[model samples]
Target: MKISILCVGRIKEKYWNDAIDEYSKRLSRYCKLEICQVADEKTPDKAPEALENQIKAKEGARLMAKMDPAALKVALAIDGKKLDSPGLAAGIEKAGLSGISHIQFIIGGSLGLSEEVLRASDKRLSFSDMTFPHQMMRVILLEQIYRAYKITSGEPYHK
Candidate 1:
């Protein structure tokens, strides 16, 4: 049940850090969790197609660098398949019980994931069609993951 979140950019804001820490603490009881924050390429004020691709590719390289070849990889993307909590819980349970031991969730930079990164994922997941700040999305992702675990354990938190 080991979980890893590899994302571009640091969580500089104190409030985002606090929320992430709280979930990390709660999840410690269930599995080992590692959060890898990588440096993000600076975005242009008015990015052109080529410039945006370059930024995403740079961030993609950083994300790919942190990846483990054997881990079950899940990429977060706007166009990815959307799953309910129960569905995600089922997927998580299946992965855990199938001897996968480790799961890596990739949250791309604010500009979005590069084609290469998306292509490498075993699963692509989306919370919504609407966009969110990468920092806040991390917290939300953690909360949903925690909820998924609770559902898996037949715990009351998911009730």
Candidate 2:
């Protein structure tokens, strides 16, 4: 099994990097884990819809190029379906059993994903209805993934 997180922007803070490193290390025991960070386009000072869409399109293109075409692509969206840990584990296991070994998760930038990228995704997953910082989302995503693996393997994980 292989898991890839195709997220926009880099983790500049040391604490964020450290947390990701720790989760990545633990997750390595379960399967191949890759963190693909694409450069986030700078938002314009004017912040017009046209400019926002253009930036999203550029970022979306980069994200699409980085992922495997055959992998199951799941986009993180605010309006996406939210799943519990067990449900997440089951979904991943089912996909694996069905021969989809590679699972790539797409986390969009500040302005969110483009329509093109969202349409290309196989599933849209959400952690909550509330908005979160895109960078912070990465950490939460990693932790959930780690928990999912533990659940699948019947290991001890506290609620």
Candidate 3:
């Protein structure tokens, strides 16, 4: 199955990019993994909350267009259900067996995902309740993907 991670904003730091690359390479043995980026919304200081919401909605629209409509979408949010490595592995295995040809993981910007994007998702996932920057979250998501692959393969990485 193809696994895609759709996120707002780009990874500008070298360290963050390297970390994401490492786990991405490891995940290739299990499935195709792709990271698709959407432009982060521009906001001026002292902007109104409504403007932030509008930006999020626009970014969500761009992200949704990049995915296959038939693919299972998982939105990563603070309120989403948290899953450990093994649990995530089980979920991924089930998704593959359940006939989902592709799975897309959506990550929003600092303001978070729009309601429309969340509504479009098949599942909601939370890595943690604590908020993380979008760039750092990229590494975390990639590592989890690799860990899930390892668990499914009955490999030592999980230990």
- Model 2, 1-159: lDDT tens per residue? 999999999989999899999999999999899999999998978798999999999999999899788999999999899999999999989999999999999999999999889999999999999989898999999999899999999999989
Candidate 3 residues 1-159, lDDT tens each?
Answer: 899999999878999988988888888888998899999888777779999889889998988788678999999999999998899999999999989879999999888999999998989999998999988988888888888888888888846
Comparing candidate 1 with candidate 3, which one achieves the higher lDDT? 1
- What candidate 1 gets wrong by more than 4 Å, as runs, is none
lDDT of 2: 0.94
RMSD (Å) per prediction: 0.9, 0.9, 1.2
* Clash pairs (backbone) in predicted model 2: none
Candidate 2, residue 91: Cα displacement in angstroms equals 0.8
| Model with the higher TM-score, candidate 1 or 3 | 1
Q: What stretches of model 3 exceed 4 Å from their correct place?
A: none
lDDT of each: 0.93, 0.94, 0.89
Question: What does the lDDT come to for candidate 3?
Answer: 0.89
